[model samples]
Target: MRGSLTTCVLFCLLSLGLSYPMMKGKPNDTSSKPFPLEDPTHNLTALADRCTDEGFDAMTLDDQGLIHLFRDGYSWSGFRGAAQFINETWNLTVSVDAAFRNHNKNQPQTHQRMYLLQGSDVWGFYEGHLLAGYPRPISQEFPGVPDNVDAAVECHAGECQTDSVIFFKGDTVYIYSPMDVPVVKQRHWAALGPCTAAFRWLERYYCFKGINFTRFDPVSGEVLSTRPLDTRDYFVSCPGRGHGHVARQNATLMSIKNRCSGRPFKAFSSDELGRTYVFRGGWYFRADSSKDGWHAWPLSHSWRNLQGEVDAAFSWENKMYFIQDSQVTIYRSNPAYTPVQGYPKPLQEELGVTEVDAAFICQSSDVLHIIKGNKLRSVDLKQSPRLPGQERPIAHTQVDSAMCNANGIYLFHGPSFYLYKDVEEMVTAAEPPEPGNIAATFLQCTE
Candidate 1:
């Protein structure tokens, strides 16, 4: 029987005009194995010749909400923060039940558990292990649903108000809820066919078919702009593999105007994330001298939704606050830097200041020092009525930007930075340290 199956598979491959490179073995040997899964970390080779060469068998979010893509005997994990897959792969061991043909979607059951359908049985996968008392009959769990499910996703919050699981099979969809009978309806979307896998990410619905995916409105099924994006480019973080790399390369090709000779418009270091960002105009440098002293890429390229230049910025409580003309945008301090909802609020309404030359909060402190020209104003953010504290004149006549760390506060003016060993000296000192060229001090640029 095994020999017959091998011959059948080889014939099918030949009929499709494809190669089947199985391990060498005797004609009747059952020990013949398929090609070994590539070690993505050590191989340093592209997983596929092209990003769209192979489609993921199953797509799902893991316990930490990171995306997990499963394909032939292998899996890839990545974050939704960016449109690129991380260059890493792992061997796949979990087996899906054969009961439901073409079932390719996985959904989270809770923070610690996920629902995986194998064959005709449903299992609760938790923390890389299957939970006990599972392998339940699919018919029992999803009563009237037929075999051959295309995909499934648990819609929550913005996608759907109630706890709902949507199962797709060809032109039919089953909206199932634990508290009610399954709601059946014919596929309403016209642009997309039956997706092999589907999942909700970043408050959007993504339906995957082969290696391409379509983002559509979950309610109306209206195909969103930029449909059929390569999953590898958008979902996987493959190194030097996506449009993001091309954008950076293009930016590098263009004259990335070096601003080391001038005052930075804004500068801040996130101790929580261990990153320092220096900005001027639309370009910003991430203070990595080894890579290059000054590589100014557009701010919008890294910070999605934020445009042009920022007046002032600071990191506080694991969130980054960017102050523009009269508005402020807050973002969770992560690789994605996802913007907090109800943001870009009136700056005056949130911080009681319409404009700022520079702003920074010291490490482990709630007092936000706002700089305007030479004047300084401190606001106690922890207080409910965040009224601006008493204003005072600073040593500098006018400063460009400011940042604070454990060592002290550094104020930028023109092309130099003046350091005050600490905040107390910043407020009470008669004279600050002799200013040093920003290029030499921070960027390690000579002359």
Candidate 2:
């Protein structure tokens, strides 16, 4: 068996700390050791050679030492890898299962991609350039879907032109539109083998099990046909996957212990242009999805004066902010997306802000809002020295974090949501009284 969806799903539940108990099967007397693998396109070295960009759109080497490139469009294998080949003169579209998403984001134009879980941290193409991204917790982002679930995502299925992605958990199936979007739109339970791979051909979806395959009705979620998967047909649909995990008669699946290893970074964030910058220790590396392989770059030198690992960072108005300790350094993005000249401004001296744990910008105004605890403050670019009216308190228990979209402020306390409008009020209103201050309003609102 190349992959055991059974094992993959088990890994997901465990990673989430789920309480599901696993049923054990008696060990089969027939067992085999791991088989040898070949690098036909030298994808391993090719990945390293590409450096700066670690994007493997599509290519694979089979047991025969035969090299394969992106012939169709995107190719993916669950928990293993995935790739997309766009920018062909024809401007073609194809479906592939890109299951490993540590981080996911959509740009202004809806150019989206998901980062993989292993070997290559990020995998996907951006603007005809394959760009790699940072690992994100997919289980948390998509709600019902797990990070390890194998997906069969297509841009057009039946009458829908937007991308649609399918997910499987145990015997259940999930369907989603705008394939790259992080939300789950639909789900269903099916009577079939744990799905290892799924593909679309001749207007129908064929989901493959270990030895059997089921053809599904694209629109109704009906299992149209269940039959054995012939080697030739299986090889045709998933060459990239086939090359990585060879089909063997008695190969046991890799254990869950193996999945949680070799992380490139501890935290990640993306910018307006859909570029994800990763940080680990004191070093920073841009996971350029438009390119391939990982040749990491040291970070201490880029942002002069500011050293030590970054506590947290975000993007506002196309400029990148790097925060370390109580200080914050600003960097301008260049053509290469690396930090350019003029930086290392003190968070307190430069913006009249200090002890900043989180940050964002109001789309409606030119101010950059900085937050620490339940307090809220804004730095108006037009206004030089920060004034009293620019700072106010958000009446919350403890402000864990905050964010801004076209809508006003969103304050998060634990798992609860509280929205506050009028940036002026949030920054200018007198601190709402605390303890015995407004028992009537507090008790009534709580009730």
Candidate 3:
């Protein structure tokens, strides 16, 4: 009997040793418990009452003054309003007029007229002609023109006249006539043809009839650059026009970094696609197909039809996370063209995440937040297991009452306009109760 007891004790000790490792790696289960940690000094009941009294259902703040509530829909309150507080301070009046309209995707045109008013002066940047209002002489001598003419002949009575007229033709005509001689009773008009040539050159440089991007400094009202849409580059597509049609692929802003310095910024482009290939700095990496999909390129790298239908992709923490067909696919970021891992695998079964309607990697935090349905939850990278079936409902938002479509959670956040994603973030930040309160809770947590 003593020998049997010894054997049993040995077995128990072995079992305990094996289980120790499992417990060591496990997360603190108590950390998952619901703890109501409010400010003790403040009356909890009064705070709750204040939430209801101050129209807490209608009030929202973001490191700024009280955020105005709107009943129209779940949109960023005071976005366009003059008094609205945006992103903290700085009262903004953002007016976006069509700078240029491209008839064809292949060719983009620029209006070359920008009027931006910040505080006082209404500065204007018109096709490189920067002025306050309509300045006089109003006309200045065109800059790019030949100094002398190759040939000058006055064809009066169908014969060469005594007046010397210089005409030099390269791609186009460059005419220089005697400035003293007034044709239409104007001195400068003698060089009118050269003026026309100069205008044409400026038009080609400033306002191309083809696809061109014209950016203006909202502060200085200066026309930044006018160039052709480079197919090798990327462009931002908002919720309107061609942007909505692309469905899965929505190119927002393109950025690049100097290969030597690694300082990333907006890359210059004069191709048909124009600067759209550039990705923003931080929390983003690129994977080329030739490298087995696991290599990092400078954020500004550009390629044509590299992934076929995949134009550009946004990711968080070097992970291939994107919302495709209302499903979130979290794959490994492969820069060298390797097959993406952590996808189409046991993760689906482990996460209890059957479907992912929309997902976003927070720009500031790099946290991967996804909406399974009516619920918003974070995928713990360390946790190989998914939440149980009971936790699924708590993580999702009900579909029937969702403000936007299944993909609505991926809206763009602008200083003025708060797209679907911003709404999701806001809702998630506002900590409310349970069930429908999960979005509010997320908002509170973010705050």
lDDT of 3 at 161: 23
Candidate 3 per-residue lDDT over residues 171-253, each given as its tens digit: 23322222333221112222211111110110111111112222222112234333222100111111121111221132231
Q: Which runs of model 2 end up more than 4 angstroms from their true locations?
A: 1-76, 79-271, 274-314, 340-342, 386-390, 413-417, 421-447
Q: Give per-residue CA lDDT, model 1, range 353-419, as digits (tens).
A: 8888999888889999999987899999998777888788888888888988766888987778898
Residue 168 displacement in candidate 3 (angstroms): 22
Model 3: how far is 102 from its true place, Å?
A: 19
lDDT of 2 at 281: 57
Q: Which of candidates 2 and 3 reaches a greater lDDT?
A: 2
Error of 1 at 174 (Å): 2.7
Q: What lDDT does each candidate get?
A: 0.56, 0.40, 0.23
- Regions of model 1 farther than 4 Å from truth: 1-52, 72-109, 142-146, 178-187, 236-241, 246-305, 312-322, 325-354, 357-447
Deviation of model 2 at 10, angstroms: 24
Q: Which ten contiguous residues of candidate 2 have the minimum total lDDT?
A: 21-30
